[model samples]
Target: MDIGTSVITPSESAEDTLPSMFWGLDPIYGVFAKLYIKDILELKKSQPVPGVFFYKTHPITKVDILGTIVQKRERERFFSFGVDDGTGVISCLWWKKQRAMENVRLASSPFGLNVLEQLNRINQLENSNSQLELGDVVQVRGRLRDYRDQREINSTSVSKVVDPVFTAQIARMLELPYLYRNFYDKTFQIQMDSSDPNQQGEPTLSLQRKIKQFLTQNGVKNFYQQELEAIDSLVCIAEQNCVSLCLHHPSQTSQDPPSSACVSKQIHELFQQAVCALQEEGIIFQKVAAHTELYLVTDAEKELHKVTRKIVQDDSTRPKYVDKGCPFHHIVSCVRHSYSAGVSEAAVQRVLDRLECDSEIVSTMDRHYTVS
Candidate 1:
């Protein structure tokens, strides 16, 4: 039965009168008198209560949330962004797998032109089913939330847009062959020395030493573009300047394809590894002001290596897919090879959940063939 809608039969009441919220004649006392009993408790408190439905497990007061940006960190694969209604704020997490959504743009510019752009986008969002973004002023409907680390939380409804703007800086790399080809081509050109077949068609001993020396001296280590972006994000965040880093994954590359879930997991795992590595080296990460950016200090390279090691460890645990490659391989290519592949957010969440539960291997267990 629904908490609020559950009918209390006459036999259940002592006097055959409906329970009233008024005092004196019919007084409501404690959590038992509320229409929704389960909606009023906390998780820590809910653990001790037996037979309580998940819905009634925690009941929080609804508060107004206004003027807040919904943000998800690059390293934290959690898809939801938190927003505030005038009364309270809640975190809204997305679960869809295939759709690619960007946050609504909020204009930071003072010029009327930029403001007009935001206004136009806001109007479009009013009719669209798209999610809110960086510069949206929306009214959220949910209960006030509290967590161990957080004092206030909310589970919000997606409704009522007030002001909308896009206030994010995304790095978009355009592959203009006329402009970037020279720089791009040099990275992949043949540095290997080899002499053309002699006119006589005889093996030339004279070219062997030069070729060997060239091969030994020059080498290339390919890196995924996303990995490079991840590293750049860390550095940018470490500087304590940017809110988030966004990169455009090139479509022309023939490298590995990335699943949505795996990419998110790799970023988060890498972040955790980076934090751990920093702690080992005496570097520390401490929270600054509320809802503000995070800071990383001391040796950046060491922290990066910590993130790298975590990525490597995570890569080893991912299962191989039949159509696309294994999630781990995709991640490895991103982190180690600097390649970018398109991945859905849902796929990323699946990978993160697997990592959290340590059940990725179970997916492969079902695929094993029985010997005859």
Candidate 2:
């Protein structure tokens, strides 16, 4: 059956009203050789709504897949690659100029050296129909499409896999049936009631409360968005709080948890939603630095801490006077006078250590300092 005819473009009503099942990250189904792709191709396509389509089996549109690029072919307007994940090989194509520019931008970033190298390799490859060389592992996120009786992916992103072992581990976890079974079970469901007065007034209040409680209870006054979104980090926090995550079959409960791929996806979605809800309510706030979101609690104490930290960090980088060098006490005094919060000597010392480690400051004789 033709799968393209059954594809659903999300409606405006669905986009605006449909509550996300989990918070921080939107759910993207995983695909490998043995799973959904093979089954989806075998199903009969049926259009259920004006823009949406279904099949005999559930239709999965957006997906995350990993494979090694065995062949690459570039045309005048598009680039295509064949990705094989042992179980199956799929064709992936990137068609838009904007997408190409985004790839370039990502490659230009400081942490994108590997990406740059990959791009360079692509450039160096001869017109022998290779944009990427054979055996280059990659992770793809895209919409699945079928054209002329062939299944292919219209890629949104195609990233070079920096850590193949870690990617393999994730792929293995996603292949487990128990993950999907647990996900469908009611035990993992987020409680939401349309009938309750509080829920009616503010539908996301309970979710916000849970997120706030999780942050506060964990003593996470400040954290990077990635740190909070990381599966291992979240699992560590959950373990510390004696919270149980239902990521496995109901019958087989174990203290040593399985890979957190499934649990992380759910938690990430919930965390994302809760953070957005809290931000909208002005309960918490985020600041972007070095292209990463840093969340901070919006309380007086935490606000003061932020100010103090900034003051010390800033002072450490400032050029020292020629006549009198910048000393540790000088930083404390400046911070104390700059803000009513009264910066402590310990805070200044801590900042010094951080700056020194970062190579932003150099310590001289007699406890004096100069910016490096």
Candidate 3:
């Protein structure tokens, strides 16, 4: 792979190896990390599988990347392409079956089609049957490997991007920075299974217990998944009020604080399991959708559920909404105006979902509710 320039190192010890750390890096197995090639090169491979790698706490076996094809070499069953994503160059192996091309050899365009559509189909077929060209901007998703002492990707799928406006490329650039800062860049500490039998009301000590205790002790009525303060709180509870991420950069002295941290894989697993168990037991629930990560405890908002139901029932009979029922926004507006101004669309959405689940309300159409 040709980089066209010398590789840039972030620090003096960036390339130097740290102590082999393999524990608690297994939960993220099969998660395809969207990352730059430079970060891929620096991934710590402590897991047994050759393809598995870790960046701090994220375990990655597969990755998807966007880059320009700088070089290409054809082989018998597969072809290799050198990809440059501005950070570095990495070789990607893309495999293909020759029989796919041999099976569908379209002689001419089919009947029920116009000139433009037929031409586009034929052009797509020809493109699929051809070799990749240099300077082509492409998307590659694959497992990573080391061959001849070089990091490379064994690509599972490949497609040439047809973006005239740089939309996809720009979108990728914008999205990856958030993921990098929120996930890939955060480090975490290795926690011990400390069993403290001295506590008066506590049960058997474990990671799940610790995290749950943290939420309860701190009175964290709600928290999002990516909240660093919550992550730090759990870490503090586990490690007894200490900044616990153990990433050992070369420049750090004995007194340096742990920086930009997250939980380890085991802690991450326990944390999620605890949250799910809490939700299952009705101790906590997300105020909105799961993607929002906005969790709320059982009595956090004192539950405007009954108020919302009455509002929906009363509004559904109004002259304007009698036939079509009440729109969802109207219910939200009523709940906020009457019950609480801080109520979110998602909270009202959850109330609607619960009402529907209990057969208390019927959905006439999209977001329109009526008394069941």
Candidate 4:
């Protein structure tokens, strides 16, 4: 069944294919394809899906990118940075959870805490960010959006990278070529059974779609990539259920469900692919801005968003938040108290970043946020 060894299946004629078919059912559509900014800027818009861009045969709706902030302009709601990835430069818009204007408004009363306390708080908050300075590197994972005839990254989450040795940026730089040559540029071997995704389609695609639907519908707050105990362990749950069904009901084989036919490693990789795909679409996130393991449903995490927002809203520029907005540590403590002890600082941080990116919360400083 794994006959797809080449880019284009020779049997398929040109007349049999359409661009939308590539956009609709291909697994690449779900991926936030990693490509050079030059390629991204050069890719023509997909005729079938106006929002999507095409890199040769690849259909790209989103991207997971790393670039340097070569130029920047801070706006009321977002920060506009000109990001250069060596290949090209593109405008990257990172919307804030807290605005600079709000900071000016909240910090109106400059005579509050001792100078040391203020400095300490500022340092503590700023420890999480490199002050988003020019020349500093940032990782932007979001959709490819064009505004005013200019291509830009409408980032879902933007975080400053602490790569003193440039390890992460370098690794991505080395990895992209292999991915492009082997995966992105290659044409998929079409399934002759059903070209349309709407009709009964590939089981793996089906499962991914189902999980995405589940996250979207339930507004699932959080999940784990490897932890089985996680409440919203989509990958783990599917794997457990599938393997269990195979053992319990010997008659129920993987052929009936292509997703189950693979080995444990394959299933894990596939599910992880699903998770990554969801990440590309902004349906699920990798984790907190500072942390990297927990995965969250983007549409989900609402209640947590509310909890973090309230901490800033009720106490902005007050004693707990001082005039600077709620400090990161205070916000963490509040989240643990209001949400659940089970939530970690990383998770809270993720929630804060999520809320901020959505403009549900605002932070004028590095780690502090004032809810708007």
Candidate 5:
């Protein structure tokens, strides 16, 4: 499949394709969700694609979801369970191949006894403690399939969630790309403002504008506290020097200007809040060094770092091949080969996801990819 052309449609607006009613159905696939059972059921189905549902206009399939197992049932051929991730509940089914394995074991008996040992090893691995249990938080990777006209997951892999809080953090991290993509849309902007009052704060907006202005004037991609402090001082000086002709004007008051300490404190607070807001919007990022945080603008520079790190890691593990006509170049391979310090598989996957979403890469087949 030409993923760049088929799976991703960055130029088209989702609203244009969405149904008139909020509950309209659509076919969506290959997306993940971290939502409650109620929210999952509320998702609209797609008319064009039968048996497919959408969440926030994004198609979901082969999802990586985190939830707590609420119930479990084991049958002769399969085990099924219900998972509730706070929003709603969904059933997950894992089919057993024990009977097939037994047949294989019996057939292998004619061969060396070593074959039976191998069969036992496979059985041990299959019956490991990875099995689902009621009340256990778990992460599941699976396809959103249907059985008996009801939505369920045909799970591919299911593992116990080591830390519920950490799993929630991972869910939020995974959702960032989608949120960032829609952030600038007018409808999304309104939705965000309605949902979070802080998003529309006048002070925060003013601070962000000022930061942009300062960065532009300095021609720098980032600014540390020292630079921010210098700018703050200049602004205070300009404010103090302003002439007030009207007696009724607040600036005409004989009261003394704010002290340097007060000015510094206020500016510090403003800058901190502005940086946080920008980071949440995926516009900037921060690094902590020696108990101080340094802010940097994110864009091409960040992209270069991510790509370069991946290439370097791949070079160490695999032979370097020309960018074009490299059969081994694959998204999963790149992620698996990545060896950056402090980087996780989730982070590498996010980079690949973003690149694919932006049409910078195309999928040739499952796990296989090429740059566009």
Candidate 6:
């Protein structure tokens, strides 16, 4: 056997020495073996020694491919090139010197790069192949060289080549706007320069509030337009309280007492006090369902009969009406049955205790009632 091909054996150590970091610094043999565009920026201060860069080529493999093109020109070219393996993609370029290699010439025509090109024939090849439809995946091997003129490192030359299977599904991933949002991971962000705190030029609190309110109103309107259609039935519309309540008769929807006296009398006696309690705490009762025709039927009807009958019967003390339905109603119903039997003061504690009851009826009750 040739001396060079003789049995492999460990040689005696002549001197202890650290292995060259060159392999560790190899572009294809990254220490971590994978990185993001932002992560590569961290290595700016300590870049690996210049050498060949071999990676799968795709749009995302190259950092700022489109941005670089856009910055150079007003718009990006039809295609952007990238290179990577399962590990990660690195942006690449082909310089004039490195592109002269014979291997670089082969990839030119298949990729539609012109052979007569003067700059880098290899670049022409890569560019020709780089015009991939959205989801095509490819593997490329090349050199990572520093462009002294450009003050940046980029891949050069052309070596191994493998075209990944192309699929239309990859087109979705090419959505530029969506990718930008994901890359930033923020719905919206803004920057403001600091100004002198003592300066009279600062915006006032009232001005800020007005601006915020305007923004909020517009945002709410836009949000409603997008989402309201799906929930129109569940949604209730209202204008500022300019409308009068018209209570509908429970037994007969067509006919309502013209006086509005009976309804008002019962409702006032029952819920007036409780309603006042809620109002004192700053809970504003707003009208619900600006144009709803159906109104609620309160227990005031029963309570009134009992009270008036007791008065005639000479009962000494009038027992308060506590056993009644919960005092919530559709606006129309509340107005129609204006007289409601509210929880009596004597039985207020019991009523409060039962408030926690999870009756399905009460749970589904109209949320449009006026609260005390």
In terms of TM-score, which candidate is strongest? 3
Candidate 6 per-residue C-alpha lDDT over 1-372 given as tens digits, one digit per residue, 9 for 90 to 100: 111111211231111111223223223243222233333332322123233222221011123222111111111422224443323444545343234445543445786766556446546766665444333443333323335422232433233323243222222223333444333222221122233331121222222233234334444312221132233221111100001112222342445433445444433322333223332221212122111221111111234323322322232122321222233222223232433333222222222223324221222121211111
TM-scores, one per candidate: 0.19, 0.32, 0.43, 0.42, 0.39, 0.19
On a 0 to 100 scale, what is the lDDT of residue 192 in model 5?
22
Every candidate's lDDT: 0.33, 0.51, 0.66, 0.66, 0.53, 0.29
Output candidate 3 Cα RMSD: 15.2
Looking at model 4, residue 122 earns an lDDT score of 66
Name the TM-score of candidate 3. 0.43
Q: How much lDDT does candidate 2 score?
A: 0.51
Q: After superposition, which runs of candidate 3 have C-alpha atoms over 4 Å from their true positions?
A: 1-27, 47-49, 100-130, 189-372
Q: Is candidate 5 or candidate 6 better by lDDT?
A: 5
lDDT tens string, model 3, 143-244? 988888888999887888989977678668866876786566655332223332222112113444665566677777777655623576565554432223
**What is candidate 4's CA lDDT for residue 52?**
82
Off-target runs (Cα >4 Å) in candidate 4 are 1-16, 19-22, 98-130, 194-372
Model 5 bad stretches (over 4 Å): 1-36, 102-116, 162-372
Model 2 residue 31 CA deviation in Å: 13
Better structure of 2 and 6 per TM-score: 2
Tell me the tens digit of each residue's lDDT in model 4 across 244-287: 43443435465565334544655565566556555655566543
